[model samples]
Target: IHRQAHLVEGFSEPFRRAVEREIRRLGVEIWAGCQVKAFGPEHVWLSDGTELIAQTRLWAGGFQVPSWLSTCGLPTGPTGALLVDKYLRVQGSEHILAVGDCADFVWGSRLLPKIGVYAVRQGPIAAQNLLRLIRGQPLIPYRPQATVFVCVTVGNRVAVAEKGRLVWRGYSATVLKNFFDWLYMRKLKPLRWQEFFY
Candidate 1:
């Protein structure tokens, strides 16, 4: 369970905080600000010079989208993110488009963060721009109105919420995060028996 703990941790702040809270509730203390320097067959090394000989370790680090846009002959940023214009069209190709994790777009002064929320917003904008191109109409610029909410699991009986500039914490927040997670999954995959499984 610890090995796969990152799956929940990497999802969102609410989830991670909730799980951490539970771990502490179980009497297991965790250290913060400790960075792992290396992993070997029998031990893990930390930046602080601490070593732990554990049979298993889980990386709760996070995720990155596999991007090979340049190999496909498209221009990409240093991070391999496909560079697209306002219409979500690939930088050098009028007919080519990029979306979701592979594409990178700037919203005003901010480089849009990679998250599922932006991908959901990009789908329709990309489709609209594609349609306009086919019909020879003026293309609509994809202006994403971005908002993010994060819930993190804090060790036992507490969670944290970052909804806009607002923040909240405690057990109520944890319950709210869990409920929202259930709602999101159900909305995405309505056929799943979320209430039973989750």
Candidate 2:
């Protein structure tokens, strides 16, 4: 169930539509603008007043930022994530940087989405900026990707993928997803990013 009007808000229109279509095709019911209001031993109730039966259920509660951020004196947005400048530096603080889900980074007109892909991409830039700061060099600003590539696994060897205007579904997409996952995990080549801290 999703509280938003669309399954994946903030994403491109075509991508969101394709993802919803593909997942629905997998026999999964997509419930937008609703939430589980309550649950019982044999039934579950939704905010929309719909009752569902038969029982294994999963709840994916939203994120909550760290409590310490509130009293730390650094500025934070409504979500409690530390507000950051384009360079990812915490507002009103020097020599401190935040990235990933913990930061409220404004990219273009809106806040950058807090997701794994953005976090992974931010890591190197954060490290590089830190090193540059130590060396008394100018920090480089993070540049978000224009086109996003995403692959979602619906069920049983099937997946859906999106890259800008392109979309793919089924087993072939799953294979592509698996290959990318394996490539990211391959140990033969490490990014050697640890050196940035040293």
Instruction: Give the winner by TM-score.
Output: 2
Query: RMSD for each model, in Å, please?
Result: 5.6, 5.8
- On lDDT, the candidate that comes out on top is 2
- Stretches of candidate 1 off by over 4 Å are 1-38, 46-50, 153-158, 178-184, 191-198
For residue 44, model 1's alpha carbon misses the true position, in angstroms, by 1.6
**Mind giving the per-residue lDDT tens digits that candidate 1 earns over 41-73?**
989887778888878787654546574565787
Model 1 clashes, total count: 16
lDDT score, residue 94, model 1? 91
lDDT of each: 0.70, 0.80
